[model samples]
Target: MSLTHLPSLHRPASHGAGVRHKAQSMLHWGLSQGLPNVVVKMAARKGDLQGLLTQAGSGDEIWEVIDQVRAQGPLVKGRVTFITADHAVVSEVLTSKAFRTGNPLDRLGFLATASIRLRPDTMHPLVEPSLLVTEPPDHTRYRKLVTRVFTMRAVEKLRDRAETVARELLDELEGRVDLVEQYCSLLPVTLISQILGIPTSERRNVLAMGSDIAASLDFGLSWPEYRDVDAGLRRFDAWQEAHIETLRKNPGDDLLSQLVHVQDEDGTLDMAELKATAGLVLAAGFETTVNLLGNGIKLLHDNPEELSKLQQDPALWPNAVEEVLRIDPPVLLTARFAPEPTTLEGQYISAGLQVVVLLAGANRDPHVFEDPTRFDVTRANARDHLSFSAGRHHCLGAALARMEGEVGLKSFFDRYPDVTLLPGAQRRPTRILRGWRTLPAQV
Candidate 1:
C-alpha cells in the first residue's frame, strides 16, 4: 500500500499517560499513521518490531526481513516511525540537511529513563553532550577541534605504527587461538590505546572499560551487562579525570594531550567536554574496527572463491575490504529526527519523530547493486556502501579504520597462509553492532 493510504487515528494533544502507556500508544499510533503496508502485514503475522527483532536471531534472518521491507517500498515504519531498507532512501535520509542526529533519549516518546535503563551513564553530563548526541553549533564546534588532531595526516603518521603493532601481535600468537580475542580485538585496542596515550599500566583496565562502553551502544542490554556498563563508566570517568589533570599540568604529544591543550576563540574544551571527547575517541576508535577485521575474515572463510581471488592478487585486498564492509557492516542501526514536519518518500513524518535507518539493509539493496547478496571481492561499487554513514556525522575515524582493516587482515593471512576457522564461532547478541563475539581458529 502507498504511504498516503496509511490509516488515520486520533492523536492525543497532550501525552499525559504514564511512560509505558504513552510509549505503547504512541508506537501503535505511529504505525497506523506512517508505517508501510508491508510492515503492518508482517506485524499481524509476527507481531511488531520487538517481536521481529527477537525472531531475527541470526544475521541471515535479519537480512531476509530487511529485504522484505525493501520490497514493499523505499520506507517502512518500525517502532521508531519512519524506517527505510532501501539504499537510495537510506542515503537521502542520512544526507538531507533537514534531518538531524537529534538526541535519541528525547525522541520516539520513549522516556529518558528507558535509555538510563540501558546504560545509566547517558544521564551524566560527562557523556550526554558529546558528539554522539549533539547537533548544529555543538557538533560543528567539537568536530572542528577534533579534526585538527584527527586528520588524515595524523592517521597516516600512525599507519607504520599500526602495521608494526599488527605484526607484533600476530608473532605472539600460538598454534591455535580465538582470533576474536587474540588478534582481532587486541591489535585495535592496543593501537588505539597508544594513539590516545593511555598509560601502559592502565591499558588493560581501559580496554576492558572501553569494551563495556562500546557494548552499551546497543539498543538495550541484559541486567548483568547493564551493571558492567555502569561500573565501566564510573571507572572510565575516574581514569579520565586523573589523566586530564596529568595532561593539563604536563602536556605531551598524544591525542589526549592535544585535546587538553586545544583552544579556539571560544577558549578550550571544558572538563566535561574533555572527558567526553577522550571517551568518544577511545570507544569509537577500536570497537567497530575490531568487527571489520573479524567480519572480513569470517566472510572470506565462508567464500573460498573470493578468498582465493584476494590471495592470488594482493592488490584486490582493498576492494575485498570494501566488499566485506558492504556485506557485513559494523554499526547496524542509526536514527535521524525531523526538526519540522516533512514528507519522506511521500510519507508524513511529524516533527520530533525518530526515523531509524538500517545500514545493513541499504548495503544489500538489489536496486543499488547487482546480485547484492553475492560475496564478490571484485565488486567495483563496493565503496558506495554507507558503512561509515554519511553527511556531517560520517565517522571521523573512517580513514583510520580502513587503514587498520587493510593492514590487520593482510598481515594475518601473510603470517598464516593456510589458517582455518574452527567450528562454533559465535556472534554478538546486540541490535546495533554486527560481528563475531568468539571466532576460534587454527594456524
Candidate 2:
C-alpha cells in the first residue's frame, strides 16, 4: 500500500549519445521492418504524451496515421518496441479470443501498478486486478457476477431516472454556463452515485474522490500528483469499505447492494472482489459518460450543419449520438496482450506483447466509412465504431451511456435551440481519457 517507489511522470533522461543512437536505431528498425506508424515513432522519441494528444486532436491526422500504418501492413510495431497499433489489426486483436487484458511483466513494472493502485489489499496493493485488468477465467468469473445486472433490460430500467437527472440539471442552466461542469460532468456522477446508493449529501465527496482515482488511469504523473492520487485512493477505499458495510447491513435495489447480496449457484464473491467490482463500476459508470456528453456536444458545435440537421429533426438524436461517438469517443485508446503467440493479419505476435488499439482511429478508418472525418449524423454505420470497444471487455455500461446521451442531447436542443459553444472551451490534458475540462456554452 506504500507509495514510496512511485515513478516520475517525465521519461528519464537518456545516457548521452549511446542512448540517442539506440533510439535512432529503434526508429530505423521500425521504418525498415514496416513496424510502427510514423506518428508512433515521433511520439516515442519525444516521450511526450502531450504531443501525442495534440497530434490526435485532429481527425484527419489520426486517420492519416492509421492509413500510414495500414499501408505498411495491418500490424506494425509502435513507438515502444513492445507495442503495436494497426486499425484493422487492432480490431481483430480486440475481438480475438487469443488476446487478453494485462501483461504481467510490462516495461513500467511496479511503477505502473503502483501508479494505478489496482489492488489495495496486498503488500503490493497497487498491483490489484480489476475487471479491466483481469484475464479469463478470472475475468469470466468476475464479469459474470455483474453481467446480468448490466444487461440492456436491467440498465433500461434507469432510463427515466437518467433522463430526469439530465433534464433537471440542464433546466437550472441560465444563459451562459460551463457545460462540462454544470451539465455533462454532473449528470453522470449524480446518476452513478444514485445507482450505487451513495447518499445525496455525500455525492460531492464521491465525485471528488472518483475524479482523483480516475486520474490514475492516465499513467504518467509527477510524484506530487501521484501522492495526491494515492491519498485520494486511500480515502476512496475507506469510504467504499464503509459503504459496503452499510449495504451489507441494509441492502437495497442499488447495484452496489446487488453486488453485496449476489450469490451464484457455485459460490459468492469475496470482499476484495466486491470492493474491486464496485470501485470499477463507480469510476467507469461516470468518467466515460461525462466525456461522451462533452465530446458529443463539442462535435456538434464544431459542425453547425450537423447540429442544424439535429435541430430540424429531433428524432435524429439517437443517430447523432452514434456519429458523435464515431467522430470523438470518450475513450481514445485501449490495449490487449497476447496471452499466447498468435498471428494477426498475417503478422506474428509474440506472447505477452501488447497491441494498443486506437479506438478513435479505427472509428475513422476510410475502408469502414465514407468521408471518414466528416461528422455526419445520418451515417448509417456509425454504430459499428469501436468506441465502446469489443468482445469480452466491451463497455458494460454502453447502453446506459447511450440512453443518457440521447436523452441529454435531445432535451438540451429542445430547450435551447440557440445554444452555441462559447469561445475558450478547454480540453482536459489527460492522455488516456479524452474530454473537455471547461466547455463553455451559451443558451
Candidate 3:
C-alpha cells in the first residue's frame, strides 16, 4: 500500500492548509485521547486496577497488576471499565450472549465519540465492518465464509508450506540476527501474503503497514502517533481497493480470490465489507503469530530445561506451543460490553458497561492452571488458555497460528540448537499487543 496514488481524502488541500490540518488533528487527539488519559492517570494514582494495568511497564509489572486484580475478586470496577482476571469470569463474559463486542469510545463523552466518528476516512481497524467489532447475523455470515478457508483440514494442507517457509527463513540467518525482523516476522507474513495472493515483493510493505496500524488496538495515542497510523490506514485503504479490483478482473487460487468469488444464500459481500474482511485477515493473519514466535524463543531461551524437554521429545512441540501461548500470550487484553443488564459470577453488570478481560491474566489463573506462573512444557490442560479468546468471537485463525508457531519455533531451534537471546531485545510499546519488537539473537 504505497502512498503515491492516495485519494483526495488522504491528501492535504494545500501547502498553507497543512498547519490547519495539524491543528485539527491535535484537537481531535485532545478530545479522543488526551482527556481520557488524564482520567486514567488520576485513577492510577488512586490505585484503580484498570489504570494500573495501563501503567504496567514490563511483563513482570503486568503480572503484578494482574495479581492485584485477582486479589480484588471476580469483578472489580475501574475508572472507565470493569476488570476481570478470573478465568471462569472471563470465559463467562466472552461466551455469554448478554455481553457483546462494542466500540471502545462508547463510554467516552459525546465530544470524544464525535471527534472519532467525524473522521470516516481514517477507519479504525477495531471499528465497524472489521470482524473484531461486528456481532450476530453479519458476524455469523462473515465467520461462515471465512471459516470455509481456515478449517483444520484446510490449515493442514498448508503445514508443508509453513514448514518450507520456516526452513527457508532460518536458512538465511547467520551467527547474529534480529530474529523478529529477519525470521519471526517474515515467516508468517510470507504465508499470509501467499494466502491473500499478495505478491512476494509487497510483503515488506504490507508488514510495515500492519505494524503501524497495530497501535489502533491500544486505548490512547498521541497526535503524532495517531497521525502516522491514520496515514498508514489511508495507504492501506487505497492499496486494498486497487488490489480487490485486480482480483475481481483476474482471480487466482488463493483464499482472497475465493473470498472475492464466494457466495452464500444471502448473496455476496459488498465492496466495503470485502475490504474490511480482507484487511482484517491481512493484519491479523500475522501480527499475533509474530509475537507467538518471538515469545516462544525468549521463553525457551530463559528455560533451558524446558527447551531440553522439547529436544528430547519432538512430539511435545504442539503442546509446547500451547504452553508458550499460555505463559506469554501475544495479545494482553480485550474489552467486551454488556448490551443489557447481565449477571456474572453473582455480580450484576449494568447495561452498556465495558468489561476488560485480561487474557494474559486469565491464562495464569490458579483456579484453572496448576502452578500458573511456572513455564512448564508438560503442563496438562495447557490448551485451555484464553489466548485465542472463546465462544462467538474466537480467533478464526487459531489453527493456523498454532501451526505457524509450532513450525516456526521448532524449525528455528532445530536449526540453531545453540541459539541465545542477546541483551538488546526490546518489547513493543503498545499496551494491547504484547511481544518483542527487536529480539537480537546469537546462533
Highest-scoring model, TM-score: 3
Candidate 1 residue-wise lDDT, 305-364, digit = tens: 887887899999888888889999988878788888888888888888778788888998
Q: Give the candidate number with the greatest lDDT.
A: 3
TM-score of 2: 0.82
The sequence of per-residue lDDT tens digits that candidate 3 reaches over residues 296-391 is 999999999999999999999999999999989998889898877877777777877789999999999999999999999999899999999999
Error of 2 at 255 (Å): 1.7
lDDT of each: 0.74, 0.71, 0.85
Better of 1 and 3 by TM-score: 3
Quote the positional error of residue 2 for candidate 3 in Å. Answer: 32
TM-score winner between 2 and 3, please give it.
Answer: 3
For all predictions, the C-alpha RMSD in Å is 8.8, 8.3, 4.2
Candidate 3 pairs with clashing backbones: none
Candidate 3 weakest ten by summed lDDT:
1-10
